[model samples]
Target chain A: MSAALLSAEALRIGYRGTSMLPELSFAVAPGTVISIVGHNGSGKSTLLKTILGLTPKLGGEIRIRRDARLGYVPQRETMDPIYPVTVGELVETGRYGIRGVGRRLTPPDRARVREMLEATGTARLERRLFRTLSGGEQQRALLARALCAEPSVLVLDEPTASMDEKGAHEAMGLTLALARKHGAAIVMVNHFIDLVAEVSDQVIHLDRDHQRVTIGPPAEVLKGRGSQGRYSS
Target chain B: MSEKLALFAASWELWRGAVAAGVVAGAVCGFVGIYVVLHRIVFVSAAMSQVSSLGVMLAFWLVQAQAIETAHHSEDILPLLFAALFTGVFSAAMAGHASARLSDRTKSSEAFIGSVYLLSSAALVLVGDQVTRGAHDVANILFGNTVIVDLPHLLLFAGVSLPIAVLHVWLRKDLLFVSFDPVMATTLGYPVTWLRVLLLVSLGMVISIGTRTIGALPVFSFSVLPPIAALALFENLRSSFWASAVIGALSAFLGYVTSFLLGLPTGASMAATAGVFLLVAKGLQRLRD
Candidate 1:
């Protein structure tokens, strides 16, 4: 019965002594996609990091209902290929909340992992080493990992930054499907305006220099900003 | 002929304890090595081992000096355990601090580890001056001591290594996620700090327990070589763990057996054997390409 799936009231985020954005507020509703666009180092990633609890919120409060769970995909560059984890095991981590601590993954959890992997079109790579996968494959594997959590909210930071045009389109399609099919609130920070405009219902812009949050429809927010439209240099 | 047989027999009796140490050492090294290779912190493993040796040597010197006046029973063992524990805990803390303080500027894991190793080496030699005659044995301990493993030490090694193996298995997924992308793992709510601490502490325990039997130098070899071998051969986390464990145990067994026959140092021999496998595995990989 809440209007917001997740809400940040006057949130402040950044490293100590060098905060990027000013006091910010935003609300994400169920089954909606919000694309956060900003220039590099504009606290876009910082905002996502703070919201997902990767970093501390410098001020204000972040509130999530006890029943809510989150699945997150970090920037493509953030993941290194040295580790020898399989896609299946990576996805299985999403089900950590389903079972009790110290307990092994149940059959249901395993099935869910398989289901998510298949749904994300990464079934054949389930046994493949995560390090050996291509960039798009890695993104799909991460998506499978996120979906396995059965989360109420999905947060992705530049999920398709390194993908080909086709891969980017597929990623957007899958992301939109994830939100629509699961009724999950999707908060994604991306640089591609045209791709986001195709899938996202709303857009939020973090103006690092001006220190403000600009939220509106994708066309309206991106209209006057041209070339530098939100993510332009 | 009988003299040769008697020497062989004497060594075989020593083999009982050495063999157990070999198994424990292999398992611990292989398990901890995964993290070292993944995180590029192999030097931390080496430094921790040296620091541990320094602690043991210091404790031995204190006990020996005290025993000159009055024979110390619990006093020797207690100080040794205390020294190892202190070094393990402190080294981990120092490494953590260095890593955090220099995250964006530069990684300080190596610098911190080197400083700690140097400090420990100085402390060890300075304190070990008390036992002039036993310096040879102490030196061997720094390298390793397959010729003189006792039952209690073997049991201690097993007790420590087994729990670490189990912990690694239980936390397999989270460890994989953290190793792959700590940023994302943290966002997904994995306790990255505590996980790293757990890994470091387990590695410390392994290093401390195997200090005498596997020797500090070769103990780290097990940690580094086996994981690399596993990485080359396997793709999955569980597969890597199993493969590393198997290869580690095999190398230990082969090392001890070959040393028994050829009169080589077991620790060095085991490390050499593991290294050879790594070469062959890498060579095979090159051939495929």
Candidate 2:
């Protein structure tokens, strides 16, 4: 692999000083997808937020490439529907990262937004209010927004949490294909263990109740958990 | 009605400055208040109004204490300078408020806004008792007097608000992005802190300058009510802002005219007019629904 897009060493995740998950380390490179799966309150979110700089790290060192352009797709619920934003407008906001604030999007930026919207199968829904979209469509539009910036690293929180089973599979497949196409490193928290196991290059399973951190390719990391892993998902 | 119109037109020279001040106050606060409404910080604007009132009262207290001697010494800008400094601190506070979850906000963020409103309101009342030698009466000091607003004061009000309105419009996208999603905005390296500072500074200017002409009550009402009416009426953000500005200006104009015709107090008249707009907006929204 080329240089890693993001790496963490002996990193612990928690609030203040209390550690919820034990020390774990992993590195992700461009064009690769890393999926994190854990039960609710298992520190999956804390760890993701820790790496993404939303929350502070409890211990250890994490480094993202200095020049990397970061993109984020929070769960649809994370966005306030009261904002009165259209899908196209929401997608266009992705360009704000690349162009910097106070600068309007240019023609090339608009083209990229359209391309991403089309790629995510959200072109037809561009004019619709983002809040009015179905769960699956909202996720796809948010995906388009995340990709619109051509980010070097993308972080997602429960991108398909609101979708149906089939939609979940499609969303993950689209995510993998899109990340590969854009050569972006993907870090996502997903509830679908099978989906994560199917598409991810690396998997991080955080069992906070056990104070355990398991990191490896899906087969190697997931093979031993059997019923517990299945039950958790 | 024609007779009233004729009478009002005849008195336009005396009321023109106050009317112009009302329109500027309405438009600027209406624009800034959209964020205040959307961010669920109506109380922040209310509290900032009290903070600005206290600052102005402090200016009056300074005059009474012989801190600065001039013609109309209460017009001194020590309050504005003080307000600007306090608002910069609130920029950080609001940034913290923006980043916290809604569940955590009541304890962590809103409590601060509540504290400021209470403390500032109390201090302003205590200080209002000491200004024995100014042209401003205690009633006019707290509620403000657009009816008596002079040319220089109107110019000053416009001077402060217009530039802030232009900046808000110019950075509309960036400001919206930061307001809607501080996490992603910060991740993307947008200047979240500076944007918050700009927003707070704008709110401060609206409250401080506005209280000088229109008083705290109408300033708060203008900042909140027209935006409420606008948000209820428009589904588009830009439309909401435009409607808000227009409604605010109209309300101010109508309120000024109504005060003259009905012999009502100017501040109360403007606030009541905004209340009437809010009711009409609610009715239209229900009908549309």
**Candidate closest to the true structure, highest DockQ:** 2
Itemize residue pairs with steric clashes in candidate 1.
B144-B215
DockQ values, each candidate: 0.47, 0.63
- Model 2 agreement with the true structure over A179-224: per-residue lDDT tens digits: 8888888899988767778778899988887888889998988886
Model 1: number of backbone collisions: 1
For candidate 2, give the lDDT. Answer: 0.81
In the range A1-233, model 1's lDDT, one tens digit per residue, is 56787888988888875677788777787788899988887888778877887667789888876678888876656666677667776777777656633568988888988888888899999878777788888888888888787878899888888676677888889877865787788899887777777777888888877867788788887777764322542
Docking band of candidate 1:
acceptable
C-alpha positional error of residue A73 in candidate 1 after TM-score superposition, expressed in Å = 1.4
Q: Which stretches of candidate 1 lie above 4 Å from their native place?
A: A164-166, A227-233, B1-11, B64-71, B91-107, B129-133
TM-score of 1: 0.90
lDDT per residue, candidate 2, B99-170, as tens digits?
A: 554212244677788898899889888887776745465566466554867887788788888998999999
Error of 1 at A52 (Å): 1.0
TM-score of chain B of each: 0.87, 0.91
